[model samples]
Target: MLRRTFSLLAAASVLALTACGSGSPSSTGGTAQGGAAGGGDLTKVSVGVIPIVDCAPVYLGNKLGFFKDEGLQLDIQTATGGAAIVPGVVSGSFDFAFSNLISVMVARDKGLDLKFVANGASTTGEKGKDVGGVVVPAGSPIKSAKDLAGKTVSVNNLSNIGDTSIKSAIEKDGGDPSSVKFVEVAFPDAPAAIANKQVDAAWILEPFMSKALADGGTVVSWNFVDVSPKLDIAGYFTKADTIMNKPELTQKFTRAMNKSLEYAQAHPQEVRDIVGTYTKIDEAARSKMTLTHWTVTFDKDAFKTLGDAAAKYGTLSKAPNAGDLLP
Candidate 1:
């Protein structure tokens, strides 16, 4: 099971520009506190989605009519860039989005108003919560972690999980983490790049990594969690004002999302089948992957973990301690 956070690391490439299906709620329906049992005319909302395994809930919710049940017509757009969700959600082109926590936390530095109301997942299962991996070509003889020096390592984003994961690996093995070069590459591109020897090794995540190995890419060290056990991950706000003013909507969205998440928790194979429809990966690739569990409540401990890591790494501009992020 793969537990992916945000970044183009999780989705398509053109999400830098976003679109939504925003309109007033359908005249025939309205969603209330009783669960989506009797919603009338629906409000069409543009929600951002990326084509990754983690977003199975969003896709599944659509298939299951969870949004419509709640009088929401979710128009999901797959994202393409790391920092684009901020502009898109704030601009109102997207009513809500399934994006990583970094994009929003990074915005706090710029003084944007937003909030993360739910916890997505922590890596679990034998897949072991490891979401990223550093791999080399097969039979390349690059045995030790030190051999990564002077070699270009590709990541889906800069200073993100892919990079941080590798950073921890480098330091643990007596390698100068900063000395190794990191190139910004997407999840799918990593396979071809590494196969063609475009880069010595790449920090990548599922399906694609599965593909690279199938094509004979050697595994140098695929254990990304062993590299860094940081909260370098999470989903961000649907809208700043929604979190601030329409708290009900925020909670409603969370509830609906958890409904889908609950279904996913009980049905893993169904999740792969659902996510497979959206991702480029095939059945074999999907079957080989591990997954993370989805939960609804946003525990303070997790946010604290994220704040501490950000402060330690200077990822936050104001050095927001855990208190700043808590409600």
Candidate 2:
């Protein structure tokens, strides 16, 4: 959510470097030829990811050898938020990355060539029981989304999906969406921010959302569900040229990623188990956290609705072209 000016400069510089250095294979070591399950030379891929419940499938997929089955050796990198991940992908630091749909759209809006290759995570679409929601301190007067007007709300990102969907929910509840102020507070820190009265409400995700509730925080809105019931929240994405020049690589990644999604969905306990390996989330929080819906397909209609809301809320200059962005 914190997009520094230098990140854009770094992106441009790295793009040029990647173009010049691409002819030679990267020095990063991978499984030897015929070492993979599919018996071919393994492509060493670097992936940027955020350490959160939404990204559990990718970690699970790697653990289950799905990537190896596709002849890939993944070198997964963790960033704090999409702010770094988006720029990393654009600059070619990552062969692929996981990010929310709105961040991808914002990158595209900025003339960065990025595309969603596979589904990452979606909302369960069940109010008060979804993976994430807006929470206020217990006994706070802000009892509903409408009451959020003129209050300071904390989101991980200011203009990305969090605030965009929240604004939609506020307007739907007859609140003046523009009247609310949004601040950037990372999910890990948001619970404390709310507790200390630093913000009127914080839109948080698991396992922090579950922790906030356990600590007596109150849920006010399931923002994603309020925006659209079938919303696809995030996905695996890569540079446009990666799709064009290395079609086979992208195809293989998509297949492996899809497999991971399906496996995670089928094995919810495994998803919780895998989450602990990458993130600092403890076992108890992992078990109690709400799991996001995982799938191989994108809900284009839901995405369009989210995009339109983003545009209306000034997150984007205009809604992104789904045909161009979606795989």
Candidate 3:
């Protein structure tokens, strides 16, 4: 069921990007100007985002006229994962994109010149009740992060936030972090993988996490919270050239996105409702799933801790310079 939903979302994302046309933004840094509800010409811009609950704010903000108020019309394209979204932004197929901080850091480490414009999601800092967690089967002997040593774990992406954070959590728990093996498994497919005993543990996020727990999966560690209470997981980012060449456009987007983040943080039910419009998560799972902490402020200290952990785990070549990365 989960695989089917992701397939549909991936197909829609491809079609949306194709329809928008790559590298079609005008000289003024917008695709085209169209009359908005506020009786003004709005610069239409494309934003690449994932189809997860993390991206609910962008959809809610658009519905609430936040983007229109900023003299912008958003062409929100959905990607199945951040990997696809990054390339779209770099190639100008998307004016901006949402991604986890680790992925953004890895891009900068590789000299991609990306800068975060607005915060996306953060850990709730509540162990055993965070937005995401590493889970083991109900009867499994693995009881804590330390037990995960030498066990195969599933993550949505390798060398990104999942494995890096889990390694940090394990090391903090007195486990041999280097001994833990990681395998790539999409979020939707993770529950089944755990149920089938294909993996000893799996790091999963909202909607899917709820499903895993329902299927008798036990949370061994809330990796994000275990890493750092102030950790900012993901945010909206764009190429550095976008900021330089189109300062006005960049500022407008940042302001609108900040407003969206603030709004989503304040209105929880609205965030749940909006998730259904973009993804296949039903109302039951939506209400039960843990929501991520949405904020406009990026936590530099938390980022430093995460980056240092990433570098130590070899996910990054070196600790990322938060001062240069965060706008």
Candidate 4:
């Protein structure tokens, strides 16, 4: 029931973005503009984005006319998970995507020529306030990471941030991460999954993290900061083909995105408002929810930590060299 309610609200937000027209692209632009090919007019690009707080910059950028001023029209495509959006990016259905740094790594490993156009969101290890956590039901026997062994846990993505971060945390807590079975469950559905005992715990993020806690989910650990004190969690990226063939457009996107990032950092309430506009998160929850730190600067240290965690958790086939990954 809660999940259904969330879906309805998300649909309304998408309609709101569409109806606003100034920030988001006109829904009628597809046939009129000839399907993101503009023919020397404003360049139209389809952007794949997960409907999460980390994507605040893209929504804010659209709302603020940053992308419009850059001579671009964004066709926003919402997806439930970053992995689910990879095919669209690879097939050119989505020119760019708002995705986690870890998801980008997985795509690159699978031979997708993804490149970073701009940094998305990062964290300074604010445990109670940041967007990552390991959560269990209120009365679950799991009280710490060590208790997670020989149990099933849920992640929004299998080989991405949730699994890697939780594994690292478990290892640090003297537990065998490999012994824990990881499953994929969308964040929106995770709280109910926990409430029904479908999964023993969930590695989730806000606003789902807060929702889960509100639904009698206890915090096993919200220590993603301990995994990487300063973390670059998400980024805006596109295919290598786009960057090479459309250098000017890519640079323009970076500039506009950076401007939006600056604005998001400077205006938390405004960011929250934008988030509420595109998500089912209520205004009250929006005010209380911890927002992701918007950043244009990529953190090499955080990337290294993520790479190391992936390698240690057996997600990466080989150790990642930053040069090969970042563009």
Ranking by TM-score: 3, 2, 4, 1
| Model 3 poorest ten-residue lDDT run | 1-10
Model 1 ranges with Cα > 4 A deviation: 1-39, 125-129, 141-150, 221-224, 227-232, 297-314, 323-327
Tens digits of per-residue lDDT for model 4, 195-287? 899999988788888898888878776656867768887888887877888788789888998999989889988988988878889998898
Candidate 1, run of 10 with poorest lDDT: 20-29
Candidate 3, residues 68-150: lDDT per residue as tens digits?
88888888876666566666666676788899998788877767788999999999988977999999988999999999999
lDDT of each: 0.61, 0.85, 0.85, 0.75
Better of 1 and 2 by lDDT: 2
TM-score of 3: 0.91
Q: How many Å off is the CA of 269 in candidate 3?
A: 0.6
lDDT by residue for model 1 over 38-109, one digit each (tens)? 745555556666678777877787788876666676666666643655566665555666666555666655
Better of 3 and 4 by TM-score: 3
How many backbone clashes can be found in candidate 4?
Answer: 0
TM-score of 4: 0.84
TM-score of each prediction: 0.78, 0.91, 0.91, 0.84
Tens-place lDDT digits, model 2, residues 1-327: 434233665754654364322332233233445545556678788777888888889899888899988878777877766777787777676788898898888888888888999999999989978999999998899999999999999998678889999999999999999999999898989999999999999999988998889889999999999999899999999888889988888898899999999999999999988888887889988888899999899999999999999899888899888998999
Model 4 clash pairs are: none
